[model samples]
Target: MGRHRRGARREVTVADLIDALRRYPADMEVRLATQPRMPQEHSIGAIAEADGLVWIGEGRQEGYASDGVAERLGWR
Candidate 1:
């Protein structure tokens, strides 16, 4: 048997996030942080272009349902 090693975590850009959202749609999850920070919300929206918002953390997995699309960036 062999041990598995975690792959290098790449810096996910806005383009990447948008692409993933389009591809997965229902499985995409994200977290956003503004200047003063805001409340926590779970939802994903359509990303047309990259804004000034910084991508603090992001990743994808299974088991998410496509309830509805969000209008702004948020958690999931």
Candidate 2:
């Protein structure tokens, strides 16, 4: 009889999220979640958290335009 083989489970890490997000267009929205007080910017890049994961996405624009603009405007 042949022994059964099992597939390895992949672990998602902060780096993994960043790589995946980079594949998308800048205009696209990437969602993740991370520590509230985490450093928002880095010397080589920036980090964003949404839905419990950290990802690298587009940087802030000159006019502060954002895909989730509606949500931000609601605070006022």
Candidate 3:
């Protein structure tokens, strides 16, 4: 994938995300990853849409990811 465009954002539709996930094995875990510099993962929680925006809950932080995650995410 290309490097993330600075300050660029793309709105992903539920169908779009689902289609992408369909390629993965069903037993794989799903989590939210953010704070790229620190590289942590969180549990996936409730998903809802309000005010024309869909929100995915950022569940509790599970733990810091291994060094590989930062490299994979191209955050370094």
Question: TM-score of every model?
Answer: 0.28, 0.30, 0.77
- lDDT-sorted candidate list, best first: 3, 2, 1
Predictions ranked by TM-score, top down? 3, 2, 1
Kindly list the per-residue Cα lDDT of model 2 for residues 1-76, writing each as its tens digit. Answer: 1112454456667666568668889887443322233312212237678888775554433233333443433322
Candidates' C-alpha lDDT: 0.41, 0.45, 0.81
For 5-74, candidate 3 gives per-residue lDDT tens digits of: 7856667777778888899999999977788888899998888989998899987899988678888777
Which residue pairs clash within candidate 3? Answer: none
Best by lDDT: 3
Q: Best candidate per TM-score, number? A: 3
Query: In model 3, which regions exceed 4 Å deviation?
Result: 1-8
Candidate 1 lDDT for residue 14: 59
Clashing residue pairs in candidate 1, if any?
A: none
Model 1 misplaced stretches (Cα beyond 4 Å): 1-6, 24-76
RMSD of each: 11.8, 13.2, 2.9
